[model samples]
Target: MSSPPVSAPPALEVTGLSHSFGRRKALDDVGFTIPQGRFTVLLGQNGAGKTTLFNLVTRLYSNRSGSIEIMGVDLRARPTVALAKLGVVFQLRTVDLDLSVKQNLLYHAGLHGLSRVQAQARIQAELDRLSLAERANDKVRQLSGGQVRRVEIARALLHKPRLLLLDEPTVGLDIGSRQTIVDHVRQLCATDGLGVLWATHLIDEVRADDAVILLHQGRVLAAGDGATLCAKAEVKDLGQAFTKLTEARAA
Candidate 1:
């Protein structure tokens, strides 16, 4: 008899994850898996411990309990190997305002140990992909908020990480700009086979086919595709489903 095909591990996985800030528990027994080559929305309202989870995953904060794994590698046991597969665009912008877009990207590339020639090629590819090629020579301060956010996204991808994390990436953008980013990232997932963990409180960003993890008060209330979540909640849309889930937990 032929053996069944073995399945690849998730792009990212968290098991029994928890964190605290002194007396306040920021995350409580949180766990979820992000599949490879897919876009998974970490849906939660502000102060829902979304950032806390990201911090732990990125090693910005020490994980006091539980575990994080990236592409089947244990983060605690093999941090460098685990982190090499991760990319992040934080909620706060980190690019230097005085530096040109290309300069910023080159600096980031150098940090990842890419040589100047290699960095140049990757920089061109990302800038072109993000529609920022014309703006590559312009100082970051010269760009609009939406353009700046695009630069951050491009910079994040320079290292070619398999898993990309974005925390509240569209917080202050116009609807058009927000939608542009949403479309571009979705296209990346389809074309490049990149796995994304997008953290957002915005309900409109969640699509029916996308994987959704509903987090409230640092706990995962639901995990499934958007359509399935709506069906399980007995709701017609994701917004109503989210409200029903959170409110039920509060009660």
Candidate 2:
């Protein structure tokens, strides 16, 4: 007998998501689905509502008008269940400089209600995977900017979330550091079947195969892989295509 094929559920899904601050609309009918084991880039310029969308996904703000599903669990109907399947890294630096690298991570683990043994096991595993186990005892302030970012990533993965979201994660990193972080995340997606939704405005970050959601002026201008977007825009590459897309929105 021939076996039936089964597909994995989307890591993250949103439909008709909209948000506003009084008269200022931040996200307007934003919607997309990120498939399991793929890297999906949310490409947008500054003030393009990337942060707003992240806020909604992390439940920092309410999604009053639309639906969000994390691993097939509705965020509104079961926030805890949905959030359990998700991990997030925001744009701002969040590690406590005064604390040791592991200390910062331990605090978060405690808040998540992970017992000492479980938290330590997960922390060590993630740090080792990131090649950061040796520095666990080091103060966060002593590490370089890039190292801190790596530590934050380790913390996010400690609970083994199915979907990972990073918003402008390399904002202040040097060119080399930026590339390193991007490459590392991409490797995770490929090697571990980790689903990643990375939000950034840097056009260079978009690869031909990775899916992209181009956001502009609080709305989605295009959604597809980099190659498709460039083909649709009739441009030479993602850089030119992104410029064309955003310019159209501005005008």
RMSD of each: 3.0, 2.7
Q: Would you give me the overall lDDT of model 1? A: 0.91
Clashes per candidate, residues 3 or more apart or on different chains:
0, 0
TM-score versus the correct structure, for each prediction: 0.96, 0.95
> Residue 145 deviation, candidate 1, in Å?
0.9
lDDT of 1 by residue, 41-158 (tens): 9999899999999999999987889999998899888998988888899999999999999999999999888899999999999999998999999999999999999999999899
Best by TM-score: 1
C-alpha lDDT values of all predictions:
0.91, 0.89
TM-score of 2: 0.95
- Could you give me the TM-score of model 1 versus the true structure? 0.96
